[model samples]
Target chain A: MTDNQRLYWRATRRLTVGLLLVWFAVSFGAGILFREALDAASIGGAPLGFWMAQQGSIYVFVLLIVIYCTAMTRLERKFGIDQKGSDQ
Target chain B: MSGPLWSWVFVGLTFALYIGIAVWSRAGSTRDFYVAGHDVPPVLNGMATAADWMSAASFLSMAGLIAFLGYGGSVYLMGWTGGYVLLALLLAPYLREFGKFTVPDFVGDRYDSRAARIIAVICALFVSFTYIAGQMKGVGVAFSAFLDVPQNWGIAIGMAIVLVYAVLGGMKGITYTQVAQYVVLIFAYTVPAIFISLAITGQLVPQIGFTSESVLPRLDRLLVELGFTEYTQTTKAKIDVFCITAALMFGTAGLPHVIIRFFTVENAQAARRSAGWALAFIAVLYTTAPAVGAFARINFIDQVNETAIDDLPAWFETWESTGYIDLDDKNGDGVVQYRAGADNEVVPNRDIFVLANPQIAGLPAWVVGLVVAGGMAAALSTAAGLLMVISSAVSHDLMRMTFRPDMTDKQELRWARISAAGAVVAAGLLGIFADNLGFVAQVVAFAFGLAAASLFPVIVLGIFWGRFNKQGAIAAMVTGLVTTFSYIVWFKFVDPDPAGWWLGISPEGIGFAFMWLALAVGVLTAVATPAPPDHIRQLVEDIRIPGAN
Candidate 1:
């Protein structure tokens, strides 16, 4: 593979792994591991840990996808791999 | 109008509309049949995927399951939706760049081996069939409860309606029809939820209404008073919750029907955006599900707890006639004390909660009918998608690619239709005979577990890891499939509780263990074996480089 291509691949992998860590934290972390601690706090009248497990994590997941989409679009442009082949 | 008549009108109208769509969008070629001619826009594809992915289990059963399981049910909420992130980022775009008609097509070409393709086909067929069986049973439950049709007849009617669209238009018809079904099912799901939420908490949005101070603490106290666990407290073991959630997330990514929905879009970028759209659409129902669960549980307890059995509401009587909810005077006190124990007199089927919620809440007859129609839409749309995947596995992967290399596109399309019809019949039979298997939700979980263990690792590694060869891919698929399937069958059907389970992971959560096993075998085999052929390496590079197409 060319150096540019290899660089693009590496950057993509780094971005994906980073985003995945966030995903894991919101779900497996707040929702599961630290659920008891969060439950002691409250959100919108329900326990925060319960809300995170049931609702908050899902909202975070949707946000994570949106972030990944926007970030990837920008990365593709920076790497000159965008569908239009222009920085814009 | 009577409830059954109203249900018929709504269900019949929806069925007619689906048939109209089938006739209008019938497939004309192999490409049209398989991938909707690869011309569907991202937003429409997203809607279609949402409908296709949200099966009867999601619409009719999940909220009921959640309502009963309380906080433990977050596994379904998180596991099912969280996988979209994996699909959008790790799998969908690269597979779209590969630009294949089916998932097995990607596997076959990636490994450059027909054997790999066939194994993938077997895995896809197994998952789709098991998944479709749950959809068919969902159809049966909805029909029997709402329309008063016998369970077998419900399965047959659902099979016939699905046969019309899926056989005629193939993926093209299924795609457009699914978009319509999504609108119907989501509206049907949220309207009743909104009504219940407003009644209970005076909040318009069910998502917030559920968490709002209006109802939860009271319900949690009531549950405790009734000797039940707190509604919002953690009830399941954390390890089990973690493993099951992981299994579901990975399993969702591996589902062939969902993956194939991405292929209908135009490009990798559209595929990425479409995944986002699909998740947004799915979130509409998923976020509402918890609220529905909470409201329904509260409503159920409010109406039934400490009430005389004979004086129970008409909805209870109706649900009892369907054998879903039973009232027995176990203590001979003649009052229903709804509590969690074998001695408890009231037994409510988890599947009945969602369908019965409208009636329990005293909603209008039309709303109840709409809920019925929505349940049917969810079941039929998902069944159509699964049948399509099974058909393509048979016609494209097994027949044309493996057996008849010289088959024309016309012949292949004919075979695809035949296979779809055959699959519907097989699924219908399975639905009828496998009534004892488990609830719709449990059966679908098995499908997800199998998919997560078998197809997920291979597909993810094929796109990302350049050194993953055919041997490693096959070994991973086989080991994952065998271990997961054997564990589930042994625990579920054979032993009912095997002492051999590691860390006390139930059959529903065991797939994640096998997934790791597959990953280890795959990496080890890849390292030990020679690298894959150079052409395969170039193909991997091509798929990785965005816009290469």
Candidate 2:
């Protein structure tokens, strides 16, 4: 693997980890732990905490995956690792 | 005669449509059977995966669980959907690029050991069987409730339908049928919710309706006045909640049925795209669930308390007489008061809250029929998906790979169909055996814990750590299996009830904790051992490359 390849992989790793962190925070963080604090805040007449636990976190999760997918396809193209059969 | 007849008509029509699709799209070759010939468009795959992922538990049990547990139940809603983030980002792409048939194929090829694949086969079977038990019985319940038939007969009918499509079509057929199921289920799920939301908050959307202004100011004030939490209030134990959420998150990424959906797509990028699409599709349902749960809880309490019990609406009287809803005037007050905590006197059956919500909230009968149809779709789609995977594992992984390497592709396809029929029969038997089991949610959680404990760690280590060998994967799987299984068995049978248990946490919640511990120990043993051979390294490289021909 060359420098370009290494850079590509590193970028991919960061993007993956970043998405996972948000996934953890929204679901385990806002949805579960801080739900009461969130309840104090309001969204569309519903408490923020209640909304996050049920709906908001899930919406964020879908967005996170779409973001990751967009980021990875770019990374794959940059590293010349775009889907292709190995020349074995 | 009214509701049950409509349910049968809707359910029966939906089943016929699925059978029609399966017959039309049945796979011809081994590749077609295995990966749907890798031609499935991303959007179609997304719909199929949604149906495959949403199971009886998600459809029949999740909102009911949330209705009871309040904020704690968000773990399931978030955890299950959030898992696709992991799948889209890390797992699906590489696995699709690897282009093999099953997860065990990835394990076996990556580790360059037949032993690794064998271990995976065991884990998949274990997970599938546990999952199937709950789903099969769910079919029985739905049948008994909506069709006015015996539970055993219901299971037999469901088993027959699944066997027909799963055996005839394989992955290709199952994929298209799953898409049809997704449409039926989503329509079924949202229609009643819309009516319930309108009735409760005058908001069209359930999510918005949950937070909208209440019809009765006094009722809202009463909730706050009586030390009862507000309808929108969120409350949960944080740390234990964290563990439960994490287990579900990882468990979702680890489920075989969900992962195999990616295999049906054309490329790694499409796999990732499809994962995103799946999350979006799944989110629509997940978000609606809490609103439905919250609104249903509020509406139910109000109805039971204020409606003078005798004139408690036609739906209630109907379900009550049918033994579905049991309402007791404990204090002779003739009103139902629903408060949090175990000590709360009024305890509505959790299952009835969501299933009967359409009727409970005065929705149209047609809408109620749709909800029943939706629940059946969820149960049937998932059951078929599980059956396909189990059968493929038997025919492809076990027989073709190990016993008869020279077997023709034609021979393999035939065996695959046979295996599917056999698996359906076996699952039907298990359903009959566990018919009188406890809550649906509890049984499903046990299966998730089993997947988390037995498969997640082994697969993760094998993919990322070069030192992970066949022995390590095998040992980890076995350790996780034994620990998780025994803990559940002990809690269910030997240990005292939840209140008497060590932590006051129930068996359903505690079983996964034991599984994680076993996974940790097993992975460590693998790390302390030797590296796999060059072929294993090659396999890893193969999976990593975008185009590996």
Candidate 3:
């Protein structure tokens, strides 16, 4: 593999691993594991944990995907691997 | 107009529009049939993916599930949507770069083994067929309720409609039709939600309305008064919720129909962006779900509790005749007291809440008609996608790749169409027998569990871990498939309870445990076996790079 390809691969792996950890923290951590502890607090007139389980985690998931897309696009450009024919 | 009359009108118009889209987008060749000639725009492909992903379960039954499960329902919400993150970051771009017409094609090439390909085909067919049966039943339920047709006839009619588009237009036709269906289903879902939210909490957005001071606190108070647990409390064991949620997330990413949607887009980058758009479109309905559940529950409680059985509201009386809602005059008392125990006099089917919400709130007849159409749209769109997957698996993977390598493209397309028609007929029969099987939502969960345990591990490991070989993939898939399937059948059918389950986890959540088992077997086998050949390792690197296609 070329130096550029190896660098791009490492960068992509780092980004995916970091983002996945965040996904786990919000969904499994805040949403399920620590839910009762978080429930003692409130958000928008509902318990914080309840909101996270049902609503807040979904919003965060959407945000995470958007971030992944943007960061990947930048990484592709940096490595000169961006598709020239892409609609983006 | 009368309710049935309005329902007929809405249903007829939507069917006509779907058929028209199918006619215009009919497939011309194998490429067009399988992946829409790989020219679909990212955002448009995303909308189609959303429609294909949000099946009848999402449109007709999910909010009802949430209404009944309360905080326990987070499994559906987080599990279904969080898988998109897995798809976008882990699966989509790499799979798109592999440039295949179907998922099994990639498996066959990556593992350099026809046996691995065949196993993948079986897994895809198993998951798609199980999921499609639930969609057919969803169609049946909507038709039986709104159009006053028998459930069997409803399944046949849904089969016929799917046959027309799915056989003729294939993926090309299904894609555009799904885009149109997405618009209809989302509009039909959100409009009634907006009205109910405004009436209940004076908030325009249902997500905000759910947390509004007017909604949750009052519902919690009334629930406590009636001897039920507070609506938002975590009543389910935390471990069970975690297992179910994890299974669903991985299963969603592994689903063949959803993964195939990425194959239709122009490039890997478009695939990534498409995954984002799909989640955004899905979130519109998902986020609104809890609010809809809250509104429906509040309305239902106010209408039934303390009311004399004979003096119940017209909706309750109507639903009672359908056997979905049963009222027992326990202790010979005329008054009905609804609560969460076996001693309660009312048995409310959770599936009824979403379908009956508009009527319970006294919405206009047209809104009810539109919601029915939306439910059918959700069912039919997903059924078409699943049928397409089944057909391609038969014609492409089983026939062309395995049995008849000399077949021409024209012959392959014909086989694809024929297989699609056969699948629709088979799924229709399954729908007819669905009641003997189980509930639509629970049946769909089993499909997810199977996909999670079997396909998810192989696909992720094949891409990320180049050391994963044909032996490891085959061993992991068979072990996962057999373990999960037998456990579900034994508990759900044979014994129905047994002495105890593995660690007391129910069949719906046990697939998550098997998913970990599959991963462990896959990694251990890879470490034991020799590494794959250099060409296969090169293929992995090629897929990892974005523009390699």
Candidate 4:
């Protein structure tokens, strides 16, 4: 791989892996694993973990995708690869 | 107009509108039929994908499941929606960059093996056919309950509507039609939710009402008093919940109908944005659904518990007539009781909660009609989307790629239409005979597990691991299908009990265990075997970036 493409790929991988960890924490972690512990607190009127499991995690999923798109766009611009032509 | 009359009016108008859209968007070429010529806007494609993904199960049955499952129901909420995160970040953009018409196209090319492609075709067909049968049944249920159409006749009508568009317009037609359907089904879901939320908690948004201070505490206490688990408490094994949600998330990301929608967009950039929009559109219903469940449950219990038969609300008899909700008055006190034990005099089927939610809350006649129309929109749009996948799997993947490499585009289009029509007839028969088959819900849910286990691992590894060769791909698919399919049949059909659950994983959750197994097997086999050819590695590298050189 070219150095330029490798740099861009590394940054993209870091971003994806980090965001995926957050996704896991919310849905699988807070939503399921730590749910009982989190239930000691509440959000609005819902038990904290219960809300995360059913409602909060879904909202976060939406946000994470938005962030991924925005961040990827910035990466493309930084790498100067945002043009419309194909390598082939 | 009265309730039934309003139903007729809405169904008539929506059906007319869908048919009109199908006519205008009819596909003239294989590109138009397969991927809408790859010019769809991100937001529009997102909406269409949402409509395709939501299905009759999401629109008609989800809230009812949530109503009963309570806190335990987060598996559907989190598992299904969370998959999109994986799609947007890891899969959709990359697959969109690959610029394929079908998932199997990518598999066949990436692995450079027709055998791999045919296996993918089988996986796609299995999931789509199983999934479509339930949708046709959902269509039938709404038609019979709301429009007074006989069940068989209802399936026939639903099949015909799907056939007109899916066979005629193909992906292009299903796209715009699904966009329209998304609007209808979302309105149908949220309007009733808003009404119930307002009536129950004086809140406009059901999600907020469900979260903010409301009637849930009293509902929980009353449920416990009636010998039930707490409403917001986990009643199932936590591991079962965990595994089921994982399987569903992986399955959703892997679903062919959903994956193919990305190729309808212009580029990978649009694919990412579309995934976001799809989730946002889906969240409209998913976030509101739990609230609908809580509200519907509270309303249902209040209306039935200790109410004398003579004084029972009108909806009681109405729903009872449909056999969705029944009152036996078993104690002979002429009063109905809905408790957890055998003494309970009410059988509130899941359908009654969602399908009957509007009437249960004393909504207007027009609202009931609107909900029925919404249910039909949800059912048919998904049916059409699945039909697209089924037809393309047979025509594009099986016919052109494998058997008839020299086939003309014109012949391919004709065959595509033929396959779609055949699928609609088969799906209709499944729906018409769903009762004797008697496992619609079980089979539809099992599709998720099947997709998760068989297709998800190979596709994900195909993109990320350049060395994932055809041998590894074939091994993964065979292992995933055999393990997941046989395990589900063994547990769900042969001996249905928790005693047989492996490590607290239910049949639906078996996919979670097997997905990881498929991934490991694929990776290990790829390493142990020869690496892929130079071109396949290069294809993988090229798909990772837009302006690769």
Candidate 5:
């Protein structure tokens, strides 16, 4: 309900939506739907689509998570909400 | 050392290591038992999570499945790993903020309803037990192939090992043991893969070998020459692939065992960091798996085709006796003929190739021994994690949350251990008879869909949507379960008709559609119903902030 909380939530939604779209595009779009079309091209002697499905997509997924983790951590710090309270 | 000797040595050493770790970090309290006292460092927790997540199936069978299915296997590769993104971004931080012992704890409190918690417990139990049975079966199969033991004996030994660690050490023992298991299993997986890759393509890294011209193009040409689908050709329908991948993604994020690992971390930042590390460690094996699959297929064909029965390797006969390799000379020919069609005389059980890969490539006996230990590690670690979830669901959710509110930590800790022991024994029995009970295999895959349809959407709603009341939560679970459960049972058992599949989406892919369907139904029902109580809304808002601590 506070302005700061509202702003943080909105920022999170923006980051999540943007990242999810990239996730969808890499895994679903190139990996499956447009696979045949992309297969005409190649990566490291493997077809791009096949590479995307088996190797490239997985690599990208990890990168996305790392990016999200760092960005989210920064976002937390920006809002002055980053805390490391000890557990009971 | 000889073959069995090497196997025994590696297996003995790993078993001793696990038991030693368990004894060193024994759980003394309920907190230590459940979430390892919430003091685990992020990177170490990540290693433990990686071990807990990659089961016997991933260790033994995923590469084999990829080999046979070719490009169609993309669904699994994308499905399993992609979900970690969702977990890190959507679920882990909020759930970690909630800081509970189990998934039901969050559901029960967030919804302010006992019914919601009970349903969550049921869903968690069903998913975990379904998954655990398969892990048990995996343990048996791996042991029989590598150790010359009967499947039942393998299951029993696995049960005893899990009993010592999980029952005594609880999650704390399981956590440290899993870190050790991760190192062993990853070393076991990658060392052989690297050797095979070097032999085949002269590449040190298997991922590079997978994409190299020597492997993919040559493998495709060889397969086409032998009347098989080209190795890289797309076989599955695009829509079905999309559906299965989505279903698995959501299902992985929803998994109670995986989700609970995040709770073991110090804070939300640690949870996010650990998710990244877990996926990185898992990707170490997953990325190598396809390369291993491709190399194994090539090696398998070369070893089988046009070879005389007497000329076949000794390992071939060994695997054949275990029923993993069936080389029936159907045409009464002295030479073995392995092709795509029915006349193909050599039909190796898919998993046999992975086990036989080292031998086929002429690796030393010690490598084979390492693999046996690796497979056992993968199976046992996952089984321990699932057993923890089962015991927690029974003792924490069903007993303390629902009825006995005044139960002390000491008493609950005892119950947790008791239930864990009970679960391992029951799972061992299921493993022994897994083949006869055909539905156990079906239920393994069914676990993901059930989680996808029921718990996944509800948990997401509980954190993100404040007004998602108990009515909507109940409705979503019921509708999700009813729809996904019936569809799987119908297609998998009764009909078995590909043409009759709804939109040609297999039961594996059906979870994809139904996840969204359940989410929509949940949202509509929640909106139509009276809003949830004010404190429940406040609780949602509280967990949304990572700094709430």
Candidate 6:
């Protein structure tokens, strides 16, 4: 495979893994199993579990994807991938 | 709450704004009508997609489901958002790369058959209609709760509003309006939750507050003492739980309204980015759902229980009067406790939690007004998006593709507008006639099941497997629809027992399982018969290149 192809694959794979980890941490870890345990931690005067389930996790998800988009765009440029439409 | 003549004025202004936005962003051509001319920014597409997706079900029903179901209900939190991962990684890029005007267009070209497109159109209609009926009802419920109007009138007004915007702007108008709706809904959903969390648990965030030790220690223990599972435990049966989660996950991915969002982006790469962005946006609402659900359940119980029946707060009396909430106080104790399973004697409508949040949290009138607007945003936004999908499929996919190939773009656009209006009228009538179609969640679930069964298989096979033919696509789609619809009917009305065992599973799960089976069988039969020609592979190659346009 070309270096560009390899770079694209690696960047996507890493981001996917990272996103999944955060997803698991918030939904499964904080939401289900360790909910009470995390409640021990507090955010904005709220317990960690409640915060994670309601607001914090969602905030994290949005930030995570924004990061992914930025990084992926950088990857595209590095690999000489031109994604812009010529139609316009 | 009554002093809000100004609130009503604000609502009028919001409505006018929506109409203005629709007119301003109206699609100019067939390409714009179909895919917003594929110039939408990834983030904007993401936001629009999120608004389109987080319907009355997500905005209104989900938090209550999580609150009642507890840990088992986390399935929605996981299942719906998790599917985005699947979409981004497995589906979005590929589908976007293979750019087509409609989902049926993809299926037809990929399978090298017009018959496939026809079958796809039917499935999309079934899916869109089943889902749209519930959205219209949701708008009525929201209006009735906050605006103090009769539900039938609320539904009619809601239908008219959706028709105006959707028919006028098509995809472009719908896209921009959805972004506004997403902002309104997310804010409306979280603000009350935060206040309630602080009140009950001394926490600002509802998500964390549910998990934290209760601010009132006795309340937590009391929940466990009253034959209720721990606030954090999973009490539901594993099999049923798994099935519900799987169906919701697959259903989200399969839904035509949601899938069509990808087409708005310029190319496959943008589509991938948009999917990620949409999920991220959706996650904000989804993750909070469980927290809101749990916190509402706890707070609601805390307020009602141990209080005298006559003294059980003014809102309860009002809610009871409206038939939205009922309190029997079965043990003759003034307090009400809600438990899982069908047998649980105490029942409260899940829809009320979000609607009642302002009163429950003791927020100001303005906040309550905001909630009203938010609920409208959720209901109307989804309704408008679905109307566009249903209408476009009718005019473009079925009419133009099949009946009137010679029709100009201008003529087609007119038909599309007419179709949008007709769909809204139909939905309004259905909402009026099926007055007892109570929960939006159940109705939306039926739509999801229909989509999963019928369209998902055809879409998947047509894209990946080159050998799939028209005959196979038709057979698969029909089989899927029949199996799913039959399962739903048999369970909903015919038996409701589900004990005699068609694979020892309940009816809801059976729909999804049958869908997968039908798809497999359809593909196998197609493969066994004959090889597809070279054009099929060529179509695949065309969709693969990033600069297809």
**Top of the candidates by TM-score:** 4
lDDT of 3 at A52: 94
DockQ of all models, two decimals each = 0.51, 0.61, 0.61, 0.69, 0.71, 0.23
Ten-residue segment with the worst summed lDDT in candidate 3 chain B?
B436-445
CAPRI-style docking class of model 4 based on DockQ: medium
> CA shift at A60, candidate 6, in angstroms?
8.8
Candidate 1: stretches off by over 4 Å: A82-88, B436-442
* Candidate 5 lDDT by residue in tens digits, B264-320: 998888998999999999999889999999999898888878899989988788878
lDDT of 3 by residue, B16-65 (tens): 99999999999999999999988899899999999999999899889998
User: Model 1, range B291-403, lDDT digits (tens) per residue?
Assistant: 99999999998899899877899999988886888788889998998987776788899988888899988999999889999999999999999999999999999989999
Q: Is the docking of candidate 3 incorrect, acceptable, medium or high quality?
A: medium
Once fitted onto the true fold, the runs of candidate 6 whose alpha carbons sit more than 4 angstroms away are A1-81, A85-88, B1-7, B215-220, B329-346, B436-441, B467-471, B501-504
- Top candidate by DockQ: 5
Which scores better on DockQ, 1 or 6?
A: 1
What does the lDDT read for residue B158 in candidate 3? 95
What CA RMSD would you report for each candidate? 2.1, 2.8, 1.7, 1.2, 1.3, 4.1
- In the range A32-85, model 6's lDDT, one tens digit per residue, is 457678878665445567455445555655666566667767776777666665
Global lDDT scores for all candidate models? 0.89, 0.77, 0.90, 0.90, 0.89, 0.73
TM-score for each of the candidates: 0.97, 0.93, 0.97, 0.98, 0.98, 0.87
Chain A TM-score from candidate 5? 0.90
Order the candidates by lDDT, highest first.
3, 4, 1, 5, 2, 6
lDDT score for candidate 3 against the true structure: 0.90
Over B86-147, each residue of candidate 2 has an lDDT whose tens digit, in order, gives: 78877887788778889888877876778878878987887787788788888888888877
Better of 4 and 6 by DockQ: 4
Query: In terms of TM-score, which candidate is stronger, 5 or 6?
Result: 5
Instruction: Kindly give the number of clashing pairs for every candidate.
Output: 0, 8, 0, 0, 0, 12
How does model 6 score by TM-score?
0.87
Between candidates 2 and 5, which one is better according to TM-score? 5
